[model samples]
Target: MNAVVHFLILLVVLSAAAFILFLLRAPFWLILLVIVAVYMAVTTVPTFHTVYKSQNLRAIDRFLLRNYRKPIFNYAYNIGHGTDEEIRNSLRTIIDKSSRGDARHVYSALLGVHSGDGDEVLAHAGKINPGPLRSYYYAYGTALNGDLDEAGRIAGKITDEWMKHTIYAVIAKKQGNPEEFRKEAKYAEDASVGIQHYLLHHNFRKMAESFNLSQEGSSMMQLVENTAVELKDGRRGLILGVRDNEEIVQYDVELGDGEIITVFAEEVRRPV
Candidate 1:
């Protein structure tokens, strides 16, 4: 796969060989082997750190975004993409069922089409009660439809700066201003909006670097990755209007393209 993975695998092999040699009571060679093994381990620390950062902080997540996001589409693709009616119908069906995984892609699919599909996605969101997904839908939905009133209203209620900036960038995209998008994307330390905006100009490598990753940064990594996919899928970001009601009270997430999604537990309505 990647260079970092290759390095780790190599480390494993060396360690294993050194262990076996020690077990065999081998004399001079075993000592030499162990020394080499120790040397390799010690020398590779910085590389490991760098690679770890690159993996969790940047690469894998961006790679996911590059390949799997389905919401947004290339600007030119909007012209002759799916028909308005088809897009509308699909948006309705998907949003009505809105599990965590499918949510982002549904948004992605909406962005991929002409603005008509974006309208339909919001319409579907309107039918839901306030909760986590609905929270996201409200903001994300408004951005897609060029409904600045609703978008701003929803964003005003969100406390998370990352979500706010992400939505701001989306609004900028709909309004046709890359500069504004870049400004919003950079609002968060974890979110490399600066890099995302650059990549929007089509520099994927730089985007990956901005998304640097590590074990502890997996969540941020996934966010970058999901954001990347949104870019790839023709969707930029999502807007959710959250309310704490009987139906929903926690955050829910969906992986890009509907493959691996996670959301909070669904509210169970009991008969009175």
Candidate 2:
């Protein structure tokens, strides 16, 4: 609807300018320049202004470079993995400067939840807006603080399938029900895609290991670090990292020729 309105307005403005120029007998080149300038003013300038006022790091980064993907989430993940001080400081700086409604805090809170730090998760939760993402972290923090019932209650109201089932899985794990955890985790994994799926799978794998349960039914196999696997092209490789997103899962695998390639999950398999 807004696009239609904008297009109508542009059309009217251009028509008026053209009429006035025709009446004034303006040069063809001069009229064309004015129209081009008006078009930029009506389109590009407002886009730049909106991005500038929002102060969204991702938006600003994309404005400068169309293909840039923010590494802020990776930095937060590193924080939970016991990264160096410099990396932690960099993440802190990014979080501090990011817009209040930005989702970076949630990523950090997820890491806190992964580490079982209720305090850290709560702190990050407070920084987020009142929404499903904030509620998700709040429930995780509550669970970590030993209130499984309340956490489950909070999670039950969440509408996002991924968030709801993932939290249920966490609550089930806390309740020492390995079967429930496995069931809920399968649902969660099925509903998730992209980076959310990757992160959730990683956390779920770690939680599953804690229960001494083999991942039997999940599509995302629990591939450990530094493991050997076979590529689909009849070659061998070592798992370097699991770091792809979207409908297809991918892994960073180093081939026998010492070349690292990000191959799809179906293109790799466990050694026979």
Candidate 3:
């Protein structure tokens, strides 16, 4: 709707320019330059206005700002180029005023800023329309707030087994219970389980080693880490770490682009 209106305005402006040029007997080159200038101003002015008045912009305008301007703002914020208060206000406005799609992206980015009050952000996210994504963040925030029971209850609303288990694994880690962490990690039916398992064992090697596996089990674990394997998701990644969580063996894999992911022993295939 906004695009249609903007297009119509452009057409009217061009028609008016042609009429004025005819009345003044303007030179053809001068008329062409005027039209180009008007076109540029019409297009450029709105973008500047939208960026400057983002909180007042409509949903579509906010979406556009998120895609185009937010990244630049985030970069500036990260490098300490922007004042902390200014950055916080801008992000808070974006989270509060933007459409759901735009708000979600901004919220995710805002989570990376350590100085922000996480509980406050989670409370804000809970007020948004109910969604699995929002619930995921809310549960994570609850866990971060040290409310494990509340986090677990919120995570229970997640129907996806992979996501539920992943959140549970995180909760387990926060509780510092290796056994519970391994139990939840085992329930994760995706590469995420591998990552969580790696994080747990890497961070708590002594507790993980106390499982007391046989020498053969140790050698197999070492081999799993040394080998490159194809994940069930079809991405081939080199195993960077391995964990023997009782009966489950999880491997940390680094993909070609250097993303650390996880995969189960069963997910591994001989590198072709």
How high is each candidate's TM-score? Answer: 0.38, 0.51, 0.34
Between candidates 1 and 3, name the one with more favorable TM-score.
1
Evaluated with TM-score, which candidate comes out highest?
Answer: 2
Residue 88 CA displacement from its true place in model 3, Å: 15
TM-score of 2: 0.51
Clashes of each: 34, 0, 0
Task: For candidate 2, list the clashing residue pairs, or say none.
Answer: none
After superposition, the stretches of candidate 3 with alpha carbons farther than 4 Å from their true spots are 1-117, 120-124, 189-272
Q: lDDT per prediction?
A: 0.45, 0.67, 0.57
For residue 145, give model 3's deviation from the true position in Å.
0.2
Error of 3 at 259 (Å): 19
Give residue 152's error in model 3 in angstroms: 0.9
Least lDDT summed over 10 consecutive residues: which range in candidate 1? 72-81
Candidate 2 C-alpha lDDT tens digits along 1-272: 13456699999988888789989999999899889888888878856563434333223322322211245543433322323553455455566766765567875786576566898998989888889988888898988998999999999999999899988998999899999999999898778754355446556776797898876432233464454565668776556678657676778865544466778788875641
lDDT at residue 204 of model 1 (Cα atoms):
21
lDDT of 3 by residue, 1-272 (tens): 23556689998998899779979999999899999999999888766655443322122222232343464444332222234565566556555666677465546434433343557647655665667666776776777778889989989999867567766876887777767866765565233322232222232332234444221111222345445455667775556678889999888876644467777788776541
Between candidates 2 and 3, the lDDT winner: 2
- Which ranges of candidate 2 are over 4 A from the true structure? 1-70, 73-101, 217-272
